[model samples]
Target: MTSTDATTSMFERIGGSDTIDLLVDRFYDRMDTLPEAKTIRAMHADDLGLIRDVLKRYLTEWTGGPKLYTPEKGHPRLRQRHFGFAIGDAERDAWMTCMRGAMEETVTNAAARQDLDKALSGLADWMRNRQ
Candidate 1:
């Protein structure tokens, strides 16, 4: 069987948009205080409200729920959007650190966590716009 057949869609595994919303909220909370995330946090504005919603919607579509992100923000073009930032190894790691922590806190299912981790890692690497 193919990987898709073997694995559950991230939407179902993640308990849908509500769970992802919690994950994104927790991620930003950690980023707001974590020293490791300071640099990356600096890239964002003081207000995280919009970012939280954007991330939740983005994740909702990315995880196979509904295509809310595109409907609202057009194509994701994640690399293009992130290209404006100085995303080097440090920034990528910092983002991943917060996300990993959030995942650990929000996702109780081992398989779901693994799936989300793998997808996030790939997306993080893809978002790296600078060396």
Candidate 2:
């Protein structure tokens, strides 16, 4: 890693709040339209407004940005929160399909995008609760 990369958080490396917003927006847009994403998309509410804001806050905190999520929601028991969903490899893949595209679109820094992709992939895998 470069000296700057070592010092900077992923949030800063990926362009902070603005890029995060773009990424989340693009991800949801993909989820809304992509054929492969239909099943996962059905898991969400008809009105995506609340979930969109929640995702923005969660990603902001997750990418080493400000503590935008925890102050209100506390430690993210992410799996527990998602236990209601029957997530498996297909669901994970569908989520990643949206996220990878969003990352490619908004995270201009190549290294940061790769790093975020790996991390997100892991997180998505962990989110899977079904066989």
Candidate 3:
């Protein structure tokens, strides 16, 4: 499921920190406005500033760019951290809707986008806390 190797990381393929910032910002923007994302959107705070920063750091490290997340936040026990939220198919789809659009806009590399989509889809599905 990993995309990084000795040559280049998925982070570099998609333009590193700049792309991560754009992707996270766009994702939150969609979640804040999309009707289909209402259910999941309500799970976040009115000000997305904090979460946006967190997500950028998380994605940066996840894509092998830097250790921004873990150094500050510790191991990404993502599911555990999100256990307070009730996640299911609808929530997963809504999250993916936001993410796919953000990736399309920010991650210019086609192959990198596809690979990222696949990986993130699995992560979103695994985040489900309900049936």
Highest TM-score: give the candidate number. Answer: 2
Residue 110 lDDT, candidate 2, scale 0-100: 96
**TM-score for each model:** 0.93, 0.96, 0.94
- Candidate lDDT (C-alpha), each: 0.89, 0.95, 0.92
lDDT of 1 by residue, 1-131 (tens): 12853666678777887789899999999999999999999999899999999999999989988888998899888888887899989999999999999999998887788878988999898888888
The predicted structure with the larger lDDT, 2 or 3, is 2
How do the candidates rank by TM-score, highest first?
Answer: 2, 3, 1
Error of 2 at 22 (Å): 0.4
Summed over model 3, clashes come to 0
Ranking of candidates on lDDT, top first: 2, 3, 1
lDDT of 3 by residue, 81-130 (tens): 99999999999999999999999998888888998899899999999999
Collision pairs in model 1: none
lDDT of 2 by residue, 14-117 (tens): 99999999999999999999999999999999999999999999999998999999999999999999999999999999999999999999999998899899
